[model samples]
Target: MDKKRIILNIVVVCLILFSLYILQNLLMPKYVSAIVEGSLIEEYYNEKADYNHDIIFIGDCEVYESFSPISLWKNYGITSYIRGSAQQLIWQSYYLLEETLKYETPEIVVFNVLAMQYNEPQKEAYNRLTLDGMRMSASKIRAVKASMMEDERLIDYIFPILRYHSRWNELTSEDFKYVFKKDKLFHNGYYMRVDVKPVTSIPRGRKLANYQFGDTAYLYLDKITKLCKDNGIELVLVKVPSIYPVWYDQWEQQIEDYASKNDLLYINFLELIDEVGIDYSKDTYDAGLHMNLTGAEKLSLYLGDVLTKTYDLTDKRTNKEYQEIWQEKIDFYEQMKAQQYYELEKYGYLKSFGAKAPED
Candidate 1:
């Protein structure tokens, strides 16, 4: 009788645990449909184990939207991945680099400088978009603690069900369809857009009381630099040719000075616009905030030249195994581009192509 009682108790506990798991999966945002950028961080984990990319990009929308890893591969044979999120902060980038080093140390770590403008946590929504997808680890825990706003809680992250359980009322078929799995959303962490939206007007950056990056921002940057140095990874600082949230002259001087002092390479794409053959008239998707496919390819071509020339990085184009892997990537990249173009031709505007940055 006692053995039977013990077996019954075990069955009951297993049932409860299984139910909790289902509920949690159902309540969490699937990010397979609208607002798809949230899936970017999580998709990194899905990359095949052999993705020992030579370069890794860390920052926000700028890096992901500006450069195409496919373009880099096709042109320069550089294997790279962009670990970016919308409005990703400096500390977030630092912790991502830390986590990435644990998995594989790349030859170069490219960090977008736009995030340096933000000194403190900005919003919970942005925080969730970035952190929610990160697999649990010491780096993720530290990232959450460093990134949480005043009203946010670490427990909420540990058990997303606590925060998202209320979403039961908002659940849809997509929630269930993607609860256990998500549609592959990005190619090598690169978001693709074939449609072109001309840059009509760019609001100028407001004059700031101070142009110097905050202490906390610099502190983490120092950590990032040191971390790379300790791991023998070259850290490259880049400013994408985004016209808004102005990359001020003061800010440029500071980054230039920092790079010079640290012996780091800093590329300000804004200055290389004409050289890169970027036409603001059509190369941008939303005004000058982000690049469309045309602009991204142009920038990638120019940057690829610089990276290969400077680093003397191997051209994996001739490599048999890399050819097999990137051929798959190329096929997927072409498929997505063709799909976006078809969507534009049929609908006259992109309907389900991920996200557009909110007005600043």
Candidate 2:
């Protein structure tokens, strides 16, 4: 071919590739300003793990919103991270745990038992919120396959631009600002809420024809249990004390039986509300659906005692390296705490840090 023709072709190809890249970037959702739970998984990759975590918590909002890793560090000297998202499913939690072990195997793995109620994929939105942040790998591929709803397409996940192409017209300033990067929104995967919305009443769970957890749920539970055993990672199963959605006696019995069978520690925090010092009136941000900062810290303190006492875990408080690393987290935690209080005082509600405010 002629020199001019070859040069023209190269320029055209470069233009096409660059255009695709920009279009893809513009079309993607920026979870920074809203629905910030979507950013939790991706944030872990961005985290500088100067010190390894002793515990890795995996589950849905229950695990992320109900526990404070900073509280664990500050009070118990226990290093931990929660790899959780909105409505994270059993298989997704399993895959997240599998992927997490590839990075650093914690001394203990805490799997929130709440996800056990879901036998299959619940919502595509939840799936996206949980799966979109994951870096591509075999685990991600399996999770995508396992978690995809009937209407969802696999190709859309492979190239998110295809799924989000319609988002072009709905683009906000957040989409552009965070197109290449995101702001730090969490402290070691713990979503913080300083505001309080006390629980007024506790409702009983409606009776069902069947209380047996589905085969798929049990299947993944077994997988999670075996995975922990094979890796020499102690797995602690806990039913986070979220006061809404009645956890049935039958469900409790099943998990208790499974824990007993596997020789694992299972603590139903719902039963120990008074011991944990969780005052639903002041500890929860959204009534009883989730805990706020005070509740989380209270629960963390109790659990930290249990973990430190039961296991041969390290107290990294005296380690200078850990002190330096955690000091940065502590600084961010205090700053965000102040910002949340400021927003609450000015707006009568939290205006930033992921939750809704007065206007936006």
Candidate 3:
């Protein structure tokens, strides 16, 4: 074949391969290899047909682990969804909300307050990964404002590929499945057991972490808060429980102070440990920050009750579809409880690891 014909054949072959890859992604069952969190993107795209939630929770893993939208549905008949990541910062959050606003508008927005610590004058490579994977608006103005003094901010928010380029190679078939699971995904939210340990002593001293509130962080926070206020939405700041002695000592007072100044209702569960029934030794998942399934459930129950009382959220459980969704979550919780109990008992490491055996 002549050179032109040869080049044309190669081009045709490449286009065919690209088409096949796209088709594979669209046809594969979700739960194969796609990252679990990417499912949120999938859900967002399909939300117009399936979703009708009254509340939306956004932030990092703290929001995912702490808030159980399913529990809210079960107890108060409110439907909600969590659009959070493992390490989402405020700038990404602003864009995430911006993108979400395109599809749905809930009555309330619960932003996990942990993003406050992500305040940096400049954006880092980490911020880019979140920005790319979540697909936030790459506005130069927003990026400049977010990174006040840091040059890295613009690239991180605009070109997230710089941060998550490695993820391309690490993508496995299972990640594809997770991303495109064919099964109907429900907004079951997270659930964990409550720690029943009694409060023995209070830690001393209150020192804040060197969490620098950069102009960008505050600007986005103010913008988010104002957006909520303008839309007639209620904004709540929540500090999910943690076992780090220093985390509690350093952040408790500072967060409380921020909440007071912003006129936001700050629910510091660290201060209400007794009320929340948190057993640091038992409820913590990593013996550090964040809670496990058991801990998530307990906190969900408490927070669900608190939210019900504080907000005028409506209940949608009467609908047949919602009932089906709640039933699925109930079954999932039952399986989780059984699995956790089995693991705890079989290892004999539960007690040593601070997990108390369930009392009969």
Candidate 4:
């Protein structure tokens, strides 16, 4: 064979290999879906194009686990969605909201403040930044334009691959499926039930001496607060309930002071733990760190009531489209609840096969 013929054959083989790789990705399961699962904000904006809601909750897993959009719909007729990330920091929350506002204008924006205290730089934050950049659309460009820093935004927009390069090896066939199969993506906008055991002592002693807010997070928080105020949106900062041991600390006071100084509505559930009916011994999902499904349900109901009474949040569940969406969410929640019960029973945590109680 001549040189040119050999080159052509090699090119053809390369193309065929690439095609096979793409096909495999499309046919796999979705184990790595959690990574992009948090990217639902981008997906929601991209898919729906034009959307609006009365309330939008943004934060880390606490937001997803604690706030049930379906519960909001069922109780208050509020059409809402949770734009939360796993271990999301303040910077990520700001960008997520910035991206979201491009397609939707929510009347109320609630931020879960648990992760706000986290000052350490995490790889996940960078990964999320890159994903958002990769998923940027015309809407995203406009959102970024309205943002504060051009250089930082450009860093993420241009080099998303660099941020998540470490995740390449972590990707499995399931992750490929999650990316290729649109249906496999979490559309219900809720999280699964997580069981927590009780702890005798709250892990303490580790403290960051000079934990100052990064310019990115601080700037975004100020901008976000102003953006909401300018648009007549109510911005509420809520510290979700965790077990007593984990929740108590000097930092709690610091957070409360910050919220008060800003004139922001800060709801610290720590004081109302008894009022919220949280039995750390039984309500926590993972000892004293977080709440389980049982805990989440109790918190959700409490939040729904608090939001209804505090804000003029209008319920949009009467709309046929919202009603249909909410029904699907309810079904998904039931399935997740059943699975949690099964796990709890299997572990011998419960006697009657009901919800798992937080163990000590």
Most accurate candidate by TM-score: 1
Could you tell me every candidate's TM-score relative to the true structure? 0.96, 0.95, 0.69, 0.72
Candidate 4 residue lDDT tens string, 1-360? 999999999999999978755644443323233344444554454334245777788877777766666666777787777777566667567766776776678888988777655544455343343245325565345433433242445454434443345566666665665565454233335554555676566666455664554555656578778878887788888888764334445656756776777778878887788888888887765665667666766777788788889888767767777677667767866765676577666875543323344556
Candidate 1 residue-wise lDDT at 180:
84
Kindly provide the TM-score of model 4 when superposed on the true structure, using C-alpha atoms. Answer: 0.72
Kindly indicate the candidate among 1 and 3 with the higher lDDT. 1
- Tens digit of per-residue lDDT, candidate 2, span 1-360: 999999999999999988888888788887887788889999999888855689999999999988899999999899999999999999999999999989988999999998888898889999999888999889999999999999998888888889999988899888888878889999999999899888988887888999999999999989999999999999999998997777889999999999999999998999999999889899999889999999999989999999999999888899898899999999999999999999989888887666666455
Tens digit of lDDT per residue, candidate 1, span 98-175? 998888989999999989899999999999989999989999999999999998999999888999989999999999
Error of 4 at 294 (Å): 1.7
Worst 10 residues of 4 by lDDT: 25-34
Query: Cα lDDT of all candidates, in order?
Result: 0.89, 0.91, 0.61, 0.63
Q: Per model, how many backbone clashes are there? A: 0, 0, 26, 10
1-360 per-residue lDDT for model 3 (tens digits): 899999999999999977655554443333312234434433544443366467777777677767676666667787777767656678767767666666677777788776776566333434433443443444434633554444454553444344344565656565465443444333443424333343344465356545455566777788888877877777777778764433544455666776788777777776777888877666665553667655665777887787778888767778888788667766866665665576666764344223555555
Q: Return model 3's CA RMSD, one decimal.
A: 6.7
lDDT, residue 195, candidate 3: 31
Q: Arrange candidates by TM-score, descending.
A: 1, 2, 4, 3
